[model samples]
Target chain A: MDEVYLFVTKKILFNLVSRPVAWFDRHIVDGFMNLIARVIERSAYMIKGFQSGRIQQYGYVFVSGTIVLVIIFIYIW
Target chain B: MNILSLFVLIPVLTCIGIVFTKNMKQTRLVSAIGMSIQLILAGLLVYLYLAERQAGNMAEMLFTYDALWFPTLNIHYTVGVDGISVAMIALTGIVVFAGIFASWKMEFLSREFFISLILLATGVFGFFISLDLFTMFLFYEIAVIPMYLLIGIWGSGPKEYSAMKLTLMLMGGSALLMVGLLGIYFYSAPDGGQLTWNLLEISKINIPIEMQRFLFPFTFIGFGILGALFPFHTWSPDGHASAPTAVSMLHAGVLMKLGGYGAFRVAIFLMPEAAQEQAWIFLILTSISVVYGAFGAIWQKDLKYINAYSSVSHCGLVLFAVLMMNQTAFNGAIIQMISHGLMTALFFALIGMIYGRTHTRMINEMGGLMKVMPFLGVVYVIAGLASLGLPGLSGFVAEMTIFFGAYQHTDTFHRILTIMATTSIVVTAVYILRVVGILLLGPIKNDHFLHLDDAKWYERLSTITLVVAIAAIGIAPLWLSDMINVSLAPIVNKISMAGFEFTSLF
Candidate 1:
């Protein structure tokens, strides 16, 4: 029974240390992969939106704003 | 110390006066009187130029004014005039006067428009007069910036977009030009001994061949964008399409010529060897502009677009003439500049009248315009004939001289390109005839066009002035050609000194 107790104690100790390390490895990798997939998906969606003319108004606004900024800079500088 | 500053300062002062004027009529009258005085002064300058030329004394520099503007940078407010500059000044005077008359009916923002117009003329006049690169650039930018406001505030049909595109493209070109100018300035002034932007002083310094090769394209293409060289020419048709009639006349008529003039005076003249080496490339691209712009106009529905593209094509011939790098071609270039100016101005003026009455630019919508406006129809046909290089018109003499000059070059490939450009003359005839046939010959289609009246007295007066000038140049080109040849002699000698032989064919 003492041997059995020793063996159970050793096993619990091993699990306590390795389980956290293993969990960390798995979750960390999965989180990284999920972040990459999210980024790629968002980029693809943005490109699709651009091709479908949904982004034109935004583009014009951005361009006009940029031009205004440039003109202001030129005027000031 | 010279009369040249008055060309710029007078208009600027008048524009300032216009700001204080109470009513539109007063503004118009003041602008007209100011321009008339300028015109007379320009005429006197031309007389001086001719008198100098006649006495076989081309070496004497007349009306030189110099003062230090930026001492640290060696930039001076230097102004001078030679024969070619005097002719260009005269051209500006005629166009400005006629443009003022053309815009006499403007009720909306009339004062503002005249102010910008006069300011633009001032810049152009200043550019032609200034002998210093920095001063010239200042005037160049001033001339170009007002175009955006003029077109945006008082224009039609997508004017804002056109204005923005034109301003951006031209300014982008100027960026390249600025880089080139600074590069030349620094390289030529390596000793750091009073860095100078004077054209004559810079020309005296022999720029390294390698550096010339690198900087040549920057300056040429940069200026070529304004000259409507092939790929950078897209802005022109759209800009001219949306511009007010007077703006279109001045912009396409004289402003575009400034580009060619700049390329000639600065790029080619400064780096003759580089220009010689790159002549083939310019020839190819300009040939394409000539042919493509003509065919492009044939497919256009709007009358303004047609004229716009034709200006592109006609201006291409000017670049092509410059690329030929011969005295005859150079003479042809000057003539083409003058001829195209008159022709395009007449075109815009006529188009404006029709648009004023019908409120549409689409040729398909209006027919039998000649039935209502016989006088306009005659002038329109004459202008069209001149544009297509008909034998009796100014375009014919210009194109023939260019071709003859280009043939003297040993490059068989360039000769073929010149031949291909000649085909555009035929294409121009096709499109011009097609436009006249569809609009003037067919049965009246739109009932709305029936109420259109003949041109008013002022319109007739302006049109007649251009028509007379076109006819005068076409019939007796020697009067202008002699002056152009006198100016081209120095350019040819400079190029020859760079080891490119320019043998006259005529």
Candidate 2:
């Protein structure tokens, strides 16, 4: 009885419930932060594409923004 | 002259006083005295405002003074203070006073620096008090124009590039704002009575729905960019990373606030139907700002850039709460503004002092600073805790109120967005703690770090003033909330009424 009980508790319960749970907990928590950080880093790359330090690029952006506003007001609205 | 006019006058006079000073000593001394006087006057104004409120003066604006400036265009120099404006003025006074001391050791063209700084303050004070859209815009430009010289002349790390970029982006925002303001002015009287730029007068008239729809975004986004709305927020991190200490303090602390205040006062208050119709779009944008800025701070190595990104996040929260458009949320928004102004000023002042001592801003390059410079290290920790929304801190109080108010909406969109924004608290804690652990704790990584001295008298004075204000709000938020709550009544009523009408249309 003791051998059977020990086998079930240690092997089945620990492996099925405790081990995977621990693995899941560690990976999920760590992975969530890393995933978000990765997403942000990727978005930042897109941001840097336009944040180019050139004056002409910034001007283009400004003019394009105004044009978009004009389109929104005149055409869409 | 109305006492409200003195807010602008004192700073102008300070600029004049700073001009005659020949050396750094005299220049800093004069600037300090003038700002100290301004701080005292601000305190007096708050007391008087409270006294008037106690005596049951439920007027919309107190201490108003009006004079015609352009008769044909119907422009006026109008000034007044509601509770919100008074709180903002007080914030400007405190930050400016602390900022003078933060830059006490500036020796390179010290007189010119002090002059430009005071001139910027004059613009901020003027902007807060102005009741007319024309003068308000004038003051807004006045506040913005000084950054070009302040940063380019005294800044570091591609100063010219940063200055030009900041100026051009803000100028773009201003151009948008100019169009929006003119639209409002022209539409001030649809029945074709005499046109006016006075805010109170304009609030009484209902602008046509189509015109409101057209102009609302222009105004909101114009101010939104300065408030560090995402995408356009690219200017802020670079500008802050390069500017001098006091300039960063004032710019981040008070100047960015102008965007939030103007959006609340003019854009939303005046165009309620449009704001109600369009709240979701800006709400999404502001949510992006809050979260994106927090994540952006995590990847930064430079100290100022981190704080600057964090400022974008906090200021974004201010706009987010404003869009909630309820009394509780509006109260939270104003408190958040004041709280952020104090907290960020404290962070920058401490960062400036640390950088001054170590001569480097990269967190990875330093360690175990608490052993050598215990004062700054401890203050930095407190600031970090505040940023992370620890209980009994200003950040916690402001954020709680904002989220609580937002939860009142009971709609799926608001609920989801609120949850999205709430995740930023976790991200904020991550970056703040990561920086604190790497920068202030652990073994000293450099042998020379042992020689570092703690905060000087002026540095201590600057940081302490801001910390006290932060703690005061954190501990007893009721009075401040009450003041803001009462003032938010008119704006909230307008929005709710507009909401009712919109539902009826549906």
Candidate 3:
């Protein structure tokens, strides 16, 4: 009886608490870093193309950057 | 001239003289002389305070100077020093004096710089001596407002943004502190007591528990933010990184101390009942800051950022030790403030001198500094050792006493937190060694730095003063501990007298 109770309790905690904590640490923390990495990469690629007169999406960069910053500030405030 | 008034008045008058000065050399000279005089006066004041304590006059403030100011709000311009206050006054003197010398070569707006610096010193001096809450609050703001111009104008690498963020965060903290102070004034005399701004008198009144609960968080978090309390400590790293050397020395060294001092003198001392009930919230956060800050420093390449994060770690100990609610821990807390102030000042001073020569702060980009600038390298080692809590240093005694007092508690949970805090020491040691090994040892990274000159004469003088002070306190802490414990006794008594077993609150 004791062994069964311990196993069940461990299962509940692992599913309920530990899983969420691990998920949050990865998705939220690493996801933010990954997103930042992606933005910088894309911007570098776009700038290189624009210097060669091949890319023409200047307006999108400012608009998207402003929107992201706005959302962050709103969350912060 | 009252001694307490001299502490404030000298700096004020010197600031005026600085404003009228025509050139940078004259400005630095005048401010340097003024700060030296303040240091002498502060030393004398500490001596007198100690004599009074020895003669059994531990009843109230040692030397209080009173005058009528702002009569409309029932506030009096009062100033005095207990054992702790006198010590802090001396700390301000040392930091400001050393700060002037450290910035001896500053050419950019040097006249304006010295003037603002001295003015800020006056406000800090006034705040430490104030017995009236209203006067204290006024001086606190006076100390804070100068940072905007100082950093925003003279600082480097995104100075304006960092300055604005620091000023806004600190002001928000003050707004919260104002609300708490007002609540205390309103609910002070629930039993037909008279209204007053005198802190000592207010402590005698039995504030209702409900009000204390509401007020304590506001006061703790309010001051805690300035002390670089965790979760709210983000501004400090950027601010310190952007600030000039002398500003970093003062900000990390003495200014952040105002937060810890205010938290203890006003927040915890006035509302012991609330402290008993709510200390756990602080302990958890402080423990996290201790560990988190250490981990944060481990990866930083910039010299100032590492020290800034280290400060967050060390300053967290001040709050953590205080919340232990034991005599030994409180003693350790005060010593930690003094210890950290001197050590961090020395560190920043050396960093400034070294960086001036190398023109780079990246650890990976510099090596064999001990070969070229041996004096700076040696002092950096000493400061880093003191920081990592090496035995026979000030940090060692402070940390040991804190641990001793912490475990004296009845609870096992706090011990677990204490262990976590203790593990941070290992992380601290690892990073300190890593930085030392990388920066001070091995061959020179760039031949450009091989011919670099070591610390100048003024820099040498500053290091000798700070190192001697650090060593003296570490080796012979008995006198300092006695003075601190004498003042701490009354606070512990008031808390114990509340008849609340603080651990039982859990």
Candidate 4:
């Protein structure tokens, strides 16, 4: 009976702590990893498209100008 | 001395002048000149308003001009500017001027287009200035009527359907507004007292809470529909997508703001108790508009449709802020109105430039556009960044204030609603970056686009002006915020005095 009580107490403590940690690992960490992976993949695709000389045909002037404007705006703000 | 009258008269007479001119160049020249003059007057008015504020009398309306139009009904042709009206008037002036310049290249029915555009501007200016409800409604309809012709006649792809949908929906809203106005008139008239539609006079009388409750939704929803509240907002995207560039810019930039301004001025200011009770409903509907609109934009392939959806989402933020019923939130709402107007105008202008060159708007078909027209691409991205509320942009400041103000309210439900609305910022980022990446950053798939040139000088001018205006507001919002706060203080005080408690949850 003494051994069984000790075992039950350990089991309750383990469940209480591990469940929240497990849930956080699954939802927060995993979700962040997924988001980062998606962003990286998208960036890689864009870089690859840039390398193939495809970006040359479209209006890069506008894109570059927009980036500069955004940077300047951010600096000022 | 007659600056307000000249602002309205110049535009009205210009419309008349354009209609009579058989030559397109002559009509264009006249319209441009008229716009230039109006811009100057607007600048003068803003300067005077600032001067007045500096002198420590910010509460009094500037450029007070009154003429009796209907003595029998006690209605007067009253036009004046508080800080809010002046800011809106300045917005209209800038947009109208830029719109004229943007449409300079149009070859189709230029005379008629300029005339209608000028007429629309006249109505907008009138709406902003008019203190009388009857005149305000008349000008509201005037501003709306030209949109039908503008879109239906000069628009592309299902123009008729889009125009009809927009006109019918807006007219339906106006009908409700008319009912609300009539209700106020009849209810306010004493057994021996004369009926009046004068806004200043009517506001003096205490409207019954029950009657206000009944009329608030009618008037609020009536005007809210144009502000692009959910479900009733279906017309905006379709209308904007089909309308010409200048029309799109004006409609999104100024006309939609009229709806929000009217709702605040007429409904909430007059019926404070009703507004307090029913604000949560607006909060819920507008939050849905913000979130759902962002999702809607993600699925759209057309450039105009994307911007149109963004407008719906951004404007939803304004309504959300208003319903928070606090000074900070209300101030944010006004700022959002102005920010969205400038940002969306920039978007439409850039899209118009691209559409002019490519003769197409499909995202799939547009790739690596940044390679050729770098200036246009960069401006497009800047506008996109602002739209998504990237920190330091006008959208970010406005949205942050709104969220902060909303969270202060003790109501957990409202706080949650605000949280839901914030998701739109993320969603907006997704679609904006997706479009930027796919359409502007990727490999140019079409061989035909290799020779595409940058935006023309006129386009450059229009775009740069908008960029400066947006940056000014984003970077140093204090000047504009102070102005808006000054105007909002009385309204906030009234709401508070009506016994609405604002408990700070934070």
Spell out the clash pairs found in candidate 1: none
Give the poorly placed runs of model 1, Cα more than 4 Å off: A1-77, B190-193
lDDT of 2: 0.89
Better of 2 and 4 by lDDT: 2
Model 4 Cα lDDT, one tens digit per residue, B232-284: 78788779999999999999999999988988889888888899889888889
Give per-residue lDDT, candidate 1, residue B127: 90
**What is the C-alpha DockQ of each candidate?**
0.01, 0.03, 0.03, 0.01
**How many residue pairs clash in all the candidates, one count each?**
0, 0, 0, 27
Clashes of 4: 27
Candidate 3 lands at a TM-score of: 0.86
> Which scores greater on TM-score, model 3 or model 4?
3
Q: Candidate 3: which stretches are off by over 4 Å?
A: A1-77, B500-506
Worst 10 residues of 1 chain B by lDDT: B53-62
User: Residue by residue across B1-506, what tens digits does model 1's lDDT show?
Assistant: 36788898789888988999888899988898898889888888888888876777767256787899777888899988776777788888878877888887988988899999999999899998988999999999999999999999998999997898789789988999998888788777655666678887777777888999989998998899899987678779779999999999999888998988888889998889999999889889999888877766766789998898898899999999888888988888878888898889999999998888888889998889999888988899999999888877888888888888877876779778988988888778878998899888789888877778988987897788788878888898887888778677777888899998778854
In candidate 4, how many Å is residue B90 off? 1.1
Better of 2 and 4 by DockQ: 2
Pick the lDDT winner. 2
Question: Residue-wise lDDT of candidate 3 within B10-75, one digit each (tens)?
Answer: 998898888888888898889989999999998898888888887889776877878877776678
lDDT tens digits, residue span B318-360, model 2? 9999998877778889999999999999999998999998899
Candidate 4 CAPRI level: incorrect
RMSD of each: 19.8, 10.1, 10.5, 19.4
